[model samples]
Target: MEVVRIGIIGLGNMGSAHAKYLIENKVKGAVLAAVCDARTERLEWAAREFGNGVARFAGIEEMYASGTIDGVIICTPHYGHPAEAVAAFKHGLHVLTEKPAGVYTKQVREMNEAAAAAGKVFGIMYNQRTQPLYKKLRDLIRQGELGEIRRINWIITLWYRSQSYYDSGGWRATWAGEGGGVLINQSPHQLDLWQWVTGMMPKRLRAFCAFGKHRDIEVENEVTAYAEYENGATGVFITSACETPGTNRLEVVGDLGRMVIENDKLTFYRLRQSETEFNRTYKGGFGEPEVWKIDIPVEGQRGQHHLITQDWVNGILHGTPLIAPGEEGLKGLTLSNAMLLSAWTDEWAELPLDEDRFYGLLRQKIEASGAAKTTEEKTLDTTGSY
Candidate 1:
């Protein structure tokens, strides 16, 4: 296939975005061939916007069988990610799904299995991974420039949503919709990066999640989670959706140095000697390792979604490595699920989370959701995204 004709399932905010860029010929070696959405209004919008050159289908299977697309980007709701991915793989099509693979890991495991069995290109929209800042941090840790990691803390709460956002119709934060709130929609990338950039996942964690803490939604809008890694490294993650003048900062402490990311700048506090080595040999009680502060250059994150799409297309055409493999998405999703599980049970959640238990509890939340929507709908943020 010289050119890949891509179909986007789910004409919601993110899917329509893919449609616009693909139709604009922004992605090399890829074209917008088809779009699928269960909503008639979205399908009509596609027809009116792209004309008949691009096919429109209400059913994904119909679009897949039409033979117009070589692959699909799943922009469906969180729960639909896995099922659609598995279907796409069964039909011998590459799959690139949006974040948080699924509401729970058990279903995502099935999707990952399908991708492995099909041997197709499976990517996820963890566009943040493309950011130069995160790349540099990962490289520094992996290269041992920071020595052994001892602690990590991230405070990313800048995603401010007006009450009208939840008031918007068909809200995804509801138990019946996304099965959770901020973590599901606004924070998946950070959750992914929490373990990804550090090359470490917490062995266990205890989380305190406040449902409707700042909003009227039923799921968590604020979260404070503490984690413990296997190597005795500790971590803290705090996120919120309604805080004003929010902050985005990350700190990683290592034996040789400390790295801080704030205000789009990376600063490293390098120790002249490893704290471990210094403590092992230093006889002076008041002495400490010398510290040097250096500011590292970093580029802003631009065209993240476009970059990820282009990477996926290139992967299909040239067998290139994917920036965010669909399987690795499970790791981030696991952390989010574990947080929710821990909060629901009022206890610590262990790694390799209990998928069945989380699944069952999520079902209970869905069954228990009885809130009535009383506000009109508003569109998702096209620039910053939902």
Candidate 2:
């Protein structure tokens, strides 16, 4: 009970990274006890890396039944996340899954339900939540410093993947294997943070998703989604392939003022008076509220993947709250799903999405996918990409 023995499922790019971090003793109160991967080559790599001290399994079931690990970190594909986490929960093991939760909300909902029923620590790898700047942004909104939000715009096109990147894996960009493109893979963190920091969910959304716009993939590579919040606030989410030097910028405007986070800097333009009140009372037709541009100080080190793992381990052993609870993952997935649905149906998709319709359409894509295409397996050093 002192040290939580952790097993990593799927020794792919992300799984191997987690394994290396644990092997290096980066996370306190956590030890790398086991690993699982269907690929024999990956299993051989694990054996070579960790030697005989770490147990190797062919799959999740074998690893779970081995009973060597107190927790499992599911880093499998988009589809495998929910099922593997649910199985881990059923076997009474804590789970810390990588982001997006799963391809869709239904399966993720089922996994969350099982985690709740099991009464075990369930966390998602929303590592960005550990960033001090985002934490401060969420706090500012929650504390009503920005007043009622009016608009949210995030231009996050930093996810530039090449054709070879998609070709490297059979499941890379295919709907049946990886679910969707940019929205599901590269944008999960931003999607989660968008709703997380704003403290608001869209009531409806319309999206224009360009499938294979930049890459030769089946899923969307470029997307422009317009969302309407319940409180009349609107949002625009724009993302694309690595066509140019990408940009990551987020701007939130409210009654009191506006806040922007870009280039690791948080700036706030505080209005002397509420914009709404000024508009209502001002006698001048064109005058607006006076504004003060202030740079909000975010002074702290930003924790990434390893810190999230540490927190997950801490949550299990010390009852510390998780940075990203598994249940909250559904919110971001909902937005992704809604955007895809809107693009497919050519209409504004509403909240509490039609799960059945989405599932049916997804199944159709899977069936039509026919044979999976794969290229040379390449694992890049994902340093600042996270």
RMSD of each: 4.0, 4.1
lDDT against true structure, model 1: 0.86
Model 2 worst lDDT window (10 residues): 375-384
Q: Model 1, poorest ten-residue lDDT window?
A: 374-383
Please give the lDDT score at residue 191 for candidate 2.
Answer: 96
Can you give the TM-score per candidate against the true fold?
0.94, 0.94
lDDT of 2 at 186: 94
Q: Which stretches of candidate 2 lie over 4 Å from their true place?
A: 373-386
lDDT (Cα atoms) of all candidates against the true structure:
0.86, 0.87
Clashing pairs in 2: 160-242
What TM-score, to 2 decimals, does candidate 1 have?
Answer: 0.94
- List the candidate 1 regions with Cα displacement exceeding 4 Å: 299-303, 371-386
